[model samples]
Target: MTDSAAEARPPSIDSSRPHPARRYNYWLGGKDHFAADRESGDQIAAVMPSIRTAALANRAFLGRAARHIALQGVRQFLDIGTGIPAPGNTHEIVQAVDPRARIVYVDNDPLVLTHARALMSGTPGTITYLDADLRDPAAILDHKDLHALLDLTEPVGLLLVAVLHFVRDDEDPDGVVATLLDRLPAGSWVAASHATWEHTPAEVVAELQKSNRDGRFVPRDGDRFRALFDSRVQIAEPGVVSVADWHNDDPGRAPAADVMCNALVGRKR
Candidate 1:
């Protein structure tokens, strides 16, 4: 059995060890992390220079996907692994298209939970926050707060942007995606931006991974990452391309060099 004391103490955050989400937040120019996250962010950036650009691209892709789905008339959103809020949050983007959009943001971070509640309150209508981890999809799905706010019988957009990279391979990532996607109805969509290193040379990926002590995440090759969508959903056009290559507003901006991630949008059949 897990030690209750260890679970209770929750470790003083060490402020030295690198955390992926916090580091990414730092890269995105968010002011919600400590010195350690900045240090780790710098370390990763030094090795993989496109880290910052990739983060920006990931955020942009989320906005584009939201707009695309909203235009298609899917108004309900189940945003798991919802990170710190910035411009173009799901509800804000969708509500612009249809004001009655219902959004539920889920995250395990206490800090994110606080920010989410603020974001929801500031938004126009029907917004909920569920303090749940992506690893615990069952707890997230079972959260009464969401069912009360969102309708499962209707098409819901499952947003997993830039978050699945935190789930290590041994955690059965494919199974995790399947479980979440399986629960939603026929027309629900699952969209994500996952970290990848295919464009980056192997040496760079190796150095960055080694520098983080393998903490950034398990680098899933294109094939393995695509396996997460297997047999469950119909991937949208331009399937699983580098974030810069996916439907972009500016093509002149050179494709983010050696992108460490890829953007994907899929619809459940």
Candidate 2:
């Protein structure tokens, strides 16, 4: 294949084992998932039933948080671990408030890159797709494509939606978060949704651990999850509550802790 032909070809995705991005795509009912993702998702769901609700709530939190930031005059976004985009996407929510808002999506998933248009095709501002891993903050921070659409000097909304659990402790996730946050200027924002077993039943936690080893999502408990945020940022209201409870005005949803996922926002100082 010619170099140009290879560049035009869809990104190569590993279908042998379930990946977190693909499996998460499956949970969101998107079409980019593979059979391995489907099978692994079902297996995990069978063991831990709340996974579906957790996923939905996670997405809801992203929407609300994006709107919150956009209203605060944030016009640039660095959305990482941007799984197969489905609904209420970061750009969609942000652009509705300020059409000139720029968004840069970063993800290691080749499938997400292949299907990156879900986050692209904005009306006013620009959108760029980066085939990079969050594990390497240096690469993402210095990426040429992302820098074009985002201004490090200006406040940008850093979206860590449903990501971060993938960073094992040996990788120093806290340090990674700090590095990313430090690069952005003051008045920047960060919104994150993380998978946790804080209040999950002990039996469910055991099963989820097995699934994490076999599948994709890395489940953390409360303390470990919150440690990923840097101390420089001031946390937003509603604190580290579950996605369902973060700024919740509804009465029907389960209590935040009951869902076992924590969602929160912080502003750079």
Candidate 3:
């Protein structure tokens, strides 16, 4: 709950075009999205109905990864491309495990920044939000707020969950990851999930590619997503599996392959 004065000056939102964060919120059954977002979500869902499931699974994976990272004694978190604040956010999960945990969430979307303050108001100084994009990891790393909240000398959880697909090939998403990790000490960890078109039918892939022509999404295969970690970071067990399968306590049930999203939590060596 931002103060009335802060709330009065909300960030500008372009509801005419569907934003990825809002569309993701809509898919996750959140109320922060506009009509355009819902329309875009519906269009994508109609082609690949499993996206809704992927969204939920991705959210759960974030919680699990955050908790696991906190349990590993890492108190600081940097979550980039954090979409519209929803239940089970990184701060909530990490703070639950370690009450003194610190978190910095970065997102370029103005609507996300507005809703972020409201959702994060309860946990004041422990959490901070930065209006930044993933394309320039260096800028985010050098930002005053991020520097103030996170100690690069110590271990920090670098969370890139379900946001990398938004970075197209020309952007060198792998280099972005490396650059960020290079700035952190050896103990820091990277937990990430990315959308993929590996197991889907050719027609399904075509439809998704056509819909994502705006370059908002660039779904990759498991190999490419995993390669982002490179030799600098080592992935943990159950390496690069679907979000539903990664550290899932549910045991017996496995989600359908076509709807799966690649997920992994790697530690810097």
Candidate 4:
């Protein structure tokens, strides 16, 4: 890692407590998680058996959205709440479309920061990582590394896949997204997905919501999820739908009820 990246590293990682990124990595069948993460993931999986499928579908949505945006001629991307290094990452997908494509990845997790080098291993100077939180859009937008790699004046792809639910309602998640979108120039696109309980059993939803009293995961319905984009963008064709169904033609795609995540791509007006 570079000096700046090392400086951004947290003092130490707390493996004793479960983190969203690590737990999600565990669910995605990655080996970068600890016992705490595994146990937490297992507990959730027991309740939501298709969570692993959901994770994979969400990952697929990210790649498809990145390619969709890149194909639209948007070469610059800002991906916040980036989880651990995974295949088909934003840089990899978009850079494949155009070698000159530039990307900035942001994540507050210390573990993700530790793997920043892997995430940024692409065309020289085409990708960078920031140790920042989505709740604090200014910190991410104002970061020198992000500005160095991405030009806000150009049409950029802003990715928020499967990350917004972690931000509680009290934190003003909509304002956070609106703030980020407000800074990007017109024609910029935002591809986002959020966990939902719309299709989940009422008893299960109640259990999940009660268990999440600490405000860790806040699942929204279709209408509430759609409201996050505000009036600054135009929802693309198909609007918000299951992550597995977005631009996916696989006959084996999991049902929306099983995936329980909604995804959408919108262009800033």
Candidate 5:
């Protein structure tokens, strides 16, 4: 965990509470989760049986989007709300296309910072991790390490995968996204996937809403999800579809109705 001199002490991990990243890891069948995380995951799974499938599909979308952006000649990436190091990480996918690609992963989780070495290892490209929260976009953009590694004047691939739902409407999620995107140069790409209940059954949606009364998760509709990009970018083809169907050519892929997540990739104008 490389920390800037100005960085404060990393936040302590609260095993008692459920974190989005850990719960996500549990859904992805990873072992770096706590009992509270499993309990939250099981509760959600009980209502949405296809949640695990949605999680997998969202991860696949991240890979596809990263590779797609990299192939387009963007060599710098800023992946915010980065969960625990998983397979097909943004660095792994993009650096494969260009060894010199630079990546900065930002996450508030102290546990994710502990796994920073794993995320940086085995890749020739420049990779660094920052202990920051999505709610404070300025902290991420102002981090010395971020400026040290990435040339923000050049085109970048901004990744906000499966993490926006953790932010409630009152927190100004749209503003948070805008702040990050506004800092990037023109021609930069942004790929984001957010949880949604648009395609879900009413009964299941009601149950999900009740289960999420604690306000840990917020599922938006398609319109709300699409509005995250604002007028600064142009959404790519097959816009605002399920993560499973985003640029995926699998013959037997799950239907968009089955996956309760919306994904999109856009280029800055």
Candidate 6:
């Protein structure tokens, strides 16, 4: 294969175990997933039929939220838990509005890092990828790469899309969000989407829980999810609604009722 072709190919990911990033890629109709990821996705979809719809909805919300923040004149971004390279990624969506946009993407998964490095080849804006976990907000905030691209005094867009659910309560997910936001300037924004069980059925919830036996996903209620933003940050308009209903540019593609994810954008006070 040509160099470009090889770059276009998905990384050699492990197929023995299901990974959240790969499974999420599969749901978003990307080619970067393995059989194990597909099987896990299929099992989740079998119980919660709207899993794919939810993924699409969450992706759409990311685009809208990024564009909104970009228009608000935030030229720097720190996107945590960035999954595999897919259509409408954070840099693509934001840089389309402002070519000068600088973005820092953080993800602990190696396969995601490989694909992300490949995607950075022809990217127009200043984009850097970091192999880091969200559980360690201090490392992310103090990283040399992050500081090189983003100025702490300037307004930045802190994106935590569909990743915080992986952070268990024991790790203090809410505190983590607060800590990251605290490191940013007052005008900076925090945009996030988290999975919830509010709209799911009891049996389906149980099955979903069983599917995530390793405790990677921790679905929260609407209030608990909102609490992640805390009182320091002021919630933006259309506060913490379903991902399908969060500032959707394409309302026709609204996800199904069972999508079960809440989204919100907040500005630091």
What's the lDDT for candidate 2? Answer: 0.80
TM-score of each prediction: 0.90, 0.91, 0.93, 0.94, 0.93, 0.92
Worst 10 residues of 6 by lDDT: 1-10
lDDT of 4 by residue, 89-135 (tens): 88889988998999888888888987887656645698888988999
Deviation in Å, model 5, residue 232 alpha carbon: 0.7
Give stretches of model 5 more than 4 Å off: 1-11, 121-125
**Candidate 3 regions with alpha-carbon error over 4 angstroms:** 1-11, 251-258
Ranked by lDDT, top first: 4, 5, 3, 6, 2, 1
Tens-digit lDDT string for candidate 1 (158-261): 99988888887778788789889888999888788887777677788678767656563766666777888868989998897877777876856447455667
Q: Model 2 over residues 1-269: C-alpha lDDT tens digits? A: 12234345464756766888888777777766667788889998898676777788888889999999998999899999887778787888998998788888888878787667544654434788898999999899999888777889999999998888788777878888988998999999999988777677788778767766633457676666666774777888867778898887888886655567888898998
For candidate 5, write residues 1-269 as lDDT tens digits: 21232144345866667888888999998877777888899998999888898889999999999999999999999999889998888888997999889999999888788788665775534989899999999999999999989999999999999989999999999899889989999999999999888888899988888768778789888799888895888999989888998999999877777788889999998
Ranking by TM-score: 4, 3, 5, 6, 2, 1
TM-score (C-alpha, index-matched) for candidate 1 = 0.90
TM-score, model 5 to reference: 0.93
Strongest candidate by lDDT:
4
For residues 1-269, could you state the per-residue lDDT of candidate 3 as single tens digits?
21234445455867768888988988898877777788889988999887888888899889998898888889999999899888888988998888899999999889888877776688878889999999999999999988888889999899999899889899999889888999999989989999887888889888877777678788889999988886888899989898888889786534746446889998999
- lDDT against the true structure, per candidate, is 0.78, 0.80, 0.86, 0.88, 0.87, 0.86
Clashing pairs in 1: 196-260
TM-score of candidate 3 versus the correct structure, residues matched by position: 0.93
Clashes per model (N, Cα, C within 3 A): 1, 0, 0, 0, 0, 0
**Shift in Å, residue 76, candidate 5:** 0.5
Clash list (residue pairs), candidate 3: none
